[model samples]
Target chain A: MSSPSGVLATGSAGDTRPAPVVSIRGVSKRFATTGDDVVALTDVDLAVAPGEFVCLIGPSGCGKSTLLNLVGGLLPPTAGRVEIGGRPVTGPPSEVGMMFQKPVLLEWRTVRENVLLPVEARNGRKGAKAARGRADELLGRVGLGEFEERYPNELSGGMQQRAAICRMLIGDPDVLLLDEPFGALDELTRERLNLELAKIVSGTDKAALLVTHNIIEGVFLSDRVVVMSARPGRIVDVVDVPLPRPRCLEVVTTPEFTALVARVRELLELGHDDDGKDGDR
Target chain B: MTAPADQRHEVPAPAAPPPDTRVAWGERPSIWVRIPTWISLSGFILVLFALWYLLSSLELVSPFILPDPMDVVAELGNMANAIGTGGLLAEALGITVLESILAFAAAVVLGLGFGFLVAESDFGRIVLMPLLVAVNAAPKIVFAPIFIAALGFGISSKVALGAFIAFFPLLVDTAAGLASVDRDKATLFRSLRISRRKTFFKLQLPSALPFIFAGLKTASVLAVIGVVVGEFIGGGGGLGQQTKIAGDLLATDRVYAYGIVLAVFGYLFYAVVAYAERKIVFWQTPHGVQAGG
Candidate 1:
């Protein structure tokens, strides 16, 4: 778990906060490949309190995505437990919304229809029909209301991804699990989205865990950046970002943000020197 | 010190995701590409008719063996009453159309049902699939006689034969389509905790529709073939049977006229399927030079 200091960010005098919205204890992930048991993640622990934005970063093939999957309840840990809102996660929970790297929008559905897909999938079309206003509101927030009726194929990659973001928020999930949500975008679009996501995160008390390769993005959006090591991945360090919110793209220019990025990079390199992969994950 | 120097340069973004392999799966091939091909096909057909016209006008060949194109057209015009009512050709066409429609509907329902069943169950694939493939591979024309012997020269025999013959393509194609769901999309559904039933209906089924419609386009033509052949073998007076009788009577113009009507009918069937496919998968359908989304 991260230090209680991080959780204290959400606390004030005379106000009680419950357990962290997301908790992982001794969690590990392994896949039985054809020839060998490939350990993707091993014995990693972490927690994210309500309203916090945590970013997980590491080298290629690190279990950053695996850990996100574990928290989303898409993958069961081979060893420990993943709990959300104090309950052990056995399968996908209603409160957890996930956004994959690709938009993964249904080609047949319109933007508005796609946004309400989870609601429709959980309840029937009538349930989704009732949430139409909410779906359009999300689309409007993402600057996609004009294109709500357009098919996914008709939209550009960036626009489709914006629709995907709207879909994730339409569910209004308590915990948002993002696997490189803006990783596929161009630099400017990614920076703009980081600022937008940070603003959205601040607006809602929903906790978000984002996995990304971009360290600048981590500094911009994260309250705490979880640095992980590769192979049978483990958390090498957690860097606290006391950066104030509604952080803008200008934060990347600050010495404090630059120092935090450098520090996380240093920890990642040091873990490589200390044989992170060679150790039991 | 180096970290400060490195930080002096802007932190680079990771490279953009590769453009999706458009060929992997997307809209139809463009109209710009299709138009010239259609013009060529029409030109080819026109050239063949012109050669036939030249041959007949020159008396270079026996008219009995190959009727003149003009004579066939004239014969078709003369048979307008027969084509409309009390005509053997009109009766034959009505029979063929009915049988094809029934066969097409049956094939789609059964083919999709069996295709999904086999794709979903390991046990079904292990046992039932091989048998289906064997039946599919067999010369389906051979079964026409058995159908006739069992159903005894009625339309039922033709319907049964048509249904069986058209069934295989839908079955095979539906199975192929269902199995073609993108891995990431499937994982997304699991993460959303969608019910298996919902997954099948909304995701697998819709995703499969494009491929399935492509199959349906093929099965539409096949269903026509099945019905005509069944009518030929089972002794009902469909276009197939009428054409055979016209051949026996050496009514070459009448035969060509029936052939013309049947060709138009087949084109209509194919066009209907193609049109339905366009509406259902409009996102992927090609327009001019490219299809997006």
Candidate 2:
């Protein structure tokens, strides 16, 4: 079975792996379409330790998002198991939060209502009063305190994505699985959101596993970046960022950040180099 | 492909800000675009009235066959005395309005309930969709006589016919709306591990609102038709019966009066639905008309 890349998986002296918030045990996914089965991920084993921030970086069709979906329990692993906080995830786990490529806010709902959707879904109308307060706190943190009553269409793409980030946080889940949440935003908005996400994730003890194609993005926000190979994806490398905590945008320009970003780029190339060979054969 | 003549290079976040943000809430439409539509509608109505007056005054058709527009207008005043709460025409109006509203209510409830059922499960959708389509294909009004026979020639028959006519579109739109939930949105619900009932109310029902309202609009208008048809064939009392009676007696002016009343009534019914739509669907920027609420 393919596991998290060897370097990061290995521990230094007295390495007793702290209980991970998320745990995947040889998880693989296969989509049975009209004809041949499409293997999305193969024997993929990984874990997110409590309060850790991990990023999965891969080329298109590398099954990184597929893996995220599996961990979120939206899709069952055909061959292996996914567990969150020591429980096998037969279905979506209440302990997890999810953010998607699009904001996925209910269009008819106001921003506050959209944020409170999961709360309402879990607790019924009784959950309303307390959840409203939590929604307000999260929205304010994301700079959307004043836009609570506005509908999604009224907000900009950046603003809508920010609200979505808040929605994911409102559940106060221990783990966050974000599938390229800022993929559609512009560069400037993306940078701003990346900072906001970093701050939000760090302030809470929630472990985060995000999938991104952007090299700099994966390196900047992640404590450790997992690089996976394409088509039947397997993690080939993991690079730990040595940059100091409370990373600012200016950190992107420094030597240590540049070295980590360069290392990730090199690892990605090596992963794809194997893909090119397999394709030729 | 070559770039368009007036355009710049490729973009996602275009250099210019989005129009959604740029345009202010109360910005007025250009005068040329706004005034022309109102002018054209008013002019068309005026021209139509003038043509009607000329054709009647010039004696193109016999006065007995076609009354003057002036006479039709005057008849509205005279018809008021003939139409009290107890009068035949007034009773007919009451019957029609009551039957349609009742049918509209019934269709909305039945359609929404059934639609949620069909949409929630694959088995329900597969079993019920074709049956609905088959029933919807045939002319709904053809059952007016059957309804009149089974339910009797009372307001019950008219309501049955109205509900029958309205059932198809309401069922279809409601099911579609509920089924149209985006996959990503559904994932959010799943990830939260929320109860199925809450998902239906908070996600599926709200998601289906626009489509359900569309069906309501169509059904509301069709309800009127259903009731009128019931009156026409089933020997009931409504504007349809009044229209038929006037035709037989050669009360051509009185026929004109009933026609105008029906037209005005139809518009008022439609306007009420539109107003409700405006209130409920306030989130959407209003454009092109739907059938009813």
**Runs of candidate 2 exceeding 4 Å displacement:** A1-17, A273-281, B1-44, B61-66, B84-86, B121-123, B286-293
**Candidate 1's iRMSD:** 8.6
- DockQ, in order, for the candidates? 0.21, 0.28
Please, what are the lDDT tens digits per residue for candidate 1 over residues A49-162?
A: 789889998877678888888898888899987888777899998899989889999988888889999988778799999999998887776656677777877676767778
* Clashing pairs for predicted structure model 2, backbone only: B217-B292
TM-score of chain B of each: 0.81, 0.80
Give me the displacement of residue B246 in model 2, in angstroms: 2.0
Global fold similarity of model 1 (TM-score): 0.86
Poorly placed runs, candidate 1 (over 4 Å): A1-18, A272-281, B1-47, B59-65, B286-293
lDDT of 2 at B62: 85
| Residue B200 accuracy (lDDT) in model 2 | 81
lDDT of 2 at B29: 67
lDDT by residue (tens digit), candidate 2, B68-105? 98888887876676575467767888888888889888
lDDT value for model 2: 0.79
